[model samples]
Target: MLALNKIRPGVNGLAVIEREVREPGPGEMLVRVHAAGVCGTDMQLYHGAGAFAQRLKLPTTLGHEMCGTVIALGPEAATPQGAGRVKVGDLVSLESHIPCWNCNACRTGRAHVCPNTRYPGIDIDGCFAQYITVPTSIAWVNPPGTAPKLAALLEPLGIAVHATLEGRGVSGQTVVVNGCGPIGLMNVAVARHFGARRVIAIDPNAKRRQMALQMGADEALDPTAAPPVQTVRDLTHGELAGVVFEYTGSPDGVRNTFAMVGALGDVRWCATPGQPMDFDFGAWRKSRPTIYNIHGRRLWDTWDVAAPLVYENHIDLQPIASHEIPLADSPRAFALILAGEAIKPLILCE
Candidate 1:
């Protein structure tokens, strides 16, 4: 079995090594990894930016945004006999983070924010391995015609879905996405699909700004070239943005989020800030705009809405999937992302 592991901090090390996979425990199913998406969260883990790697018990397999095929089921599992609900070969996409169902947050239907959460590829062994055993509860069966490469993006799409839907519906509203990263680009399409009158995308990178336009942004603004706040306001006919999705973790981006939002509108922030942010409460108070800090995709809340978008071809991910490489070339894939050359790199794990 081949697997990629983060043996320690600040090093890729001998991450991809051969190993044997143990059999599934009770209530577990062994999945043969088919495809895994290299997410920004994975980059943060590689660079030791977030608290993810620090909390992890090291020498762990490192992959979370993944899809696989169920190969085996545990003895105690009720999975059907031959090719039952999910048989020997059933394509599936995993949710990655599974909450302790007994926790207070889980009981209150806030499982996405559950404090006691175990995430694959972060807190526990992940799909970087050729084979991974996971609880069936977190696995979703992909429809027959869904592309494995596209299926790998469902997790990140769920994030965009959750973030954009957090505010009052974006339909016929003006929206500005504060970053043009992969997730931010996804939001541009999502907001457009939901009937946002105008979608303004902001980024420092020239290529990404163009990519945002390609991905359905009505206007792409390079914040470094001209002030994005003024640009967004101008695009909105001096109305400011009815809704703003802040996906950049930089201080400038965060501060600009407050500036770009319309009075009495909502700002949905999904970026994980590495440091404390300095906010202008006076300005926010005066504007009376609402701020919504998004964590994980609102559990299953937004998935229902997003799944249909994908199923009905309302949002296409082909443009955003900038690179597709085999699992053996993961090191190169990581390098491409670290260099900011690739948008969404999907590794073929099968």
Candidate 2:
């Protein structure tokens, strides 16, 4: 088998390499990779650009958001917690985080932030290969007949789900999504699907703003030109949005969040910036809105929020899948993303 390997640290270290297929060990299973999505985190790893990438070692497989068919299961002896849930020929989506159940974060209902996390494509071999091995615990069974390409996005969509539905009221409330990247745009659709009264999508990129419209946003704005707070207020007839979602990782977006959201509204920061942001406590004090720093999906909770929406075809992912490439051509694939032509690229490894 051949896998996309990050052979060393830093940029220019990854390549396609040959490898033997490893059978599932106890508590693990072998999956035949079908469709995988190249993600921003994957790009960050490619560029060695952040603290998240610093934790990674070399000689690891290079993709994570994927869906595959279960090829083989480990012998049934004391399997992982989610074991006995899948069998040969079952199609499943991959949950990229591997958490140690013993950690305080895990024990106290915050496993999504488990410090001891094993993220494939970083901490271990990943899915950008014809065959890959993942613990049964991280595999989620998909509905029969789900599109593999869209199923590949399940992992990232879980983030949008966690950010949108994790104890915040969106139904009938105006919402502002301050970015139109793939996940950011997905957040727009998820908010709309949750029956948000008006969904405003903000981005400087014309292409992404247009994509946001396609995903069901009521309006799209050029963040640089339109004063997001005032624009949203106008769109809602002198009332600002009740919820503001920050996914731009830009300081301007952060600054605008407190302004875009209405008094007593909610603000959720879902994207992590490359640098620490300086925030004003004064605006936050005045707005009096609840703020949430959205970590990744809330384990099984976000999955439950996402699965039905995906299975029911309520949230569309096709428009965001801008490019598809073969695993051997992943180097070019990553380049395309860096070049900004492809927002979400899918790699077909099988």
Candidate 3:
């Protein structure tokens, strides 16, 4: 099997090499990798960020967002039935992280926050290979005829869906997305499709601003030139955004999120700050805005609602995928993402 792996910790140590995949054990399924999507976290791993260097066992395959077909099922495993159900030859997208079911969060239906979670391509071997084995419980079957490339995007799309659909409906509300990365761009499209009357996309990149508009943002502004809060307020006719989704990990963007949100509005901070953000409680108290720190997608049933949106074409992810490269060329793909030249890069493993 061909796999892309980060063999050791360094500025650049990722390598594409061949490995032998052990067959599936009990309750596991052997999946033939079809397409795997690269994410910002993968870029971080390439640059030796996150807990990858510490938590990951060495020489680990590093890809999480993946779509595949069940090549073989282990003993006691049975496929589900329905429009999008897993079976032999069924196209499927995997939930990369499997939580320990005994955790407090998992028991309370918030498995996304599971304290003892095992993530593929991070904590274990991932799908940047010819074949990978996963617990059947974490796999979701895509509807027949769905594009393999598109199906590979379900993981990150689920994140956007969870962020946008967090609280009450966003229909006809004024919304602001405080980043124009791939997930942020996905939020732009989801916000519009969910009936946001005005969508403000904030990013420092001029290209991303244009991409945001194409993704359905009503207005795009650079946070560096003009203050994003002021621009958003001006566009909203002096009314601050009813909802703000912060997708940038930058300290400035975090600070601006407090200013851009309206009084009593709900603000979903969706970015994972690489460092501690010096947030002001004074501003938060004055505005009295509701703040929700969104992590990964919801645990129990979030994917059920989210998957249909893509399948129904309510949110188009095709534009967000800026590049498609073979698994062997993953190092260059990492470079493009690090350089901010690629939005979402998909790695075709098969």
Candidate 4:
């Protein structure tokens, strides 16, 4: 098997190397990966910073957003928790978060925020390889004829869906997506499909702003050219947005998110900054908006809503998958993202 591994610490220490394939362990499944996507978490590992980077054991494969076919299952894979769940020949998209189902959070249906959660790309060998062995509990089986590349996107799309469906929902509200990254752009489309009265997108990147318009944002603003907070306020006729999604993790962007929302509005804080930064609780108190800290998708609950949007063609993800590179040339995908030239790049593993 050929895998993309973080062979060394610090920036850009990735290499594609040949390795012997490992068989699945008890309650696990072996998958032949068809496609994978590079995400923000992978970028943190690439830079050798953040908590995820600190948790990495060197020479680990670095991917979790993927779609693959089941080739084999380990002993007891069909017994206990996974009984009658996944099986050979099923096409599946990974859930990314490997939670300890015995924990309080998992036992009470809050597994997405399980304190003992482990991530594939950061904790164990990941799907950047031709084959990956993962616990069968995390696989979401796709319809037999579903497109593998699009299925690979479902994991991220789940985040957008979860945000859109959070407190107060988007229907009939003036929504603002304060960043135009892959997930943010997905939120723009999702907000529109769920009946948002108006959707506004904000990003400094010209290309992203243009893509936001394509994804159903009524207007896209370049924050660098004009202040997004005032622009959003003016566009809303002084009412401000009813909901604001915070995807830009910068300090300035965070402050602007608070200022852009109307009093008593919902603020879905999706992205995490790499380091600690100052914040003003006084301003937040004055704004009186409720802040929702979004983590990964809400396990099966989110998948149920997200997967259908893609499978039924209710939202178009084609534009977000801006580039595709072969598995051997996967490093270039990271380069494209770093250069701000690609939205979401798919690695063709098959």
Best by TM-score: 4
| Candidate 2 per-residue lDDT over residues 1-350, each given as its tens digit | 98988777777588899977888888888999999998888888888879757877777788889999998988761364665888788899998888886789988877889989888888878899999888888888898899999899999999988888855668989899998888998999999988898899999888888899999988999978868778787787877888899888878888888788888888988878889889889878987889888888887888988988888888878988899999888788888877777879899998
Question: lDDT by residue for model 3 over 80-123, one digit each (tens)?
Answer: 31122456787889887787767789888888889888888888
Model 2, residue 288: what's the lDDT?
88
Off by over 4 Å in 4: none
lDDT of 1 at 94: 82
Residue 348 in candidate 4, Cα distance off native in Å: 0.3
Query: Across residues 80-193, which tens digit of lDDT does each residue of candidate 1 receive?
Result: 212235555778888867877677998888888888888988877887778888777677777777777777788889989888878696998988899888889999999888
Q: Lowest-scoring 10 consecutive residues by lDDT in candidate 3?
A: 76-85
lDDT of each: 0.81, 0.86, 0.84, 0.94
Q: Which one wins by lDDT: 1 or 2?
A: 2
Model 1 TM-score? 0.95
**On a 0 to 100 scale, what is the lDDT of residue 30 in model 2?**
91
Best by lDDT: 4
Q: Candidate 1, overall lDDT? A: 0.81
Give RMSD to native, each candidate. Answer: 2.4, 1.6, 2.2, 0.8
TM-score to true structure, per model: 0.95, 0.95, 0.95, 0.99
Q: Lowest lDDT 10-mer window, candidate 4?
A: 75-84
Deviating ranges (above 4 Å) for candidate 1? 78-87
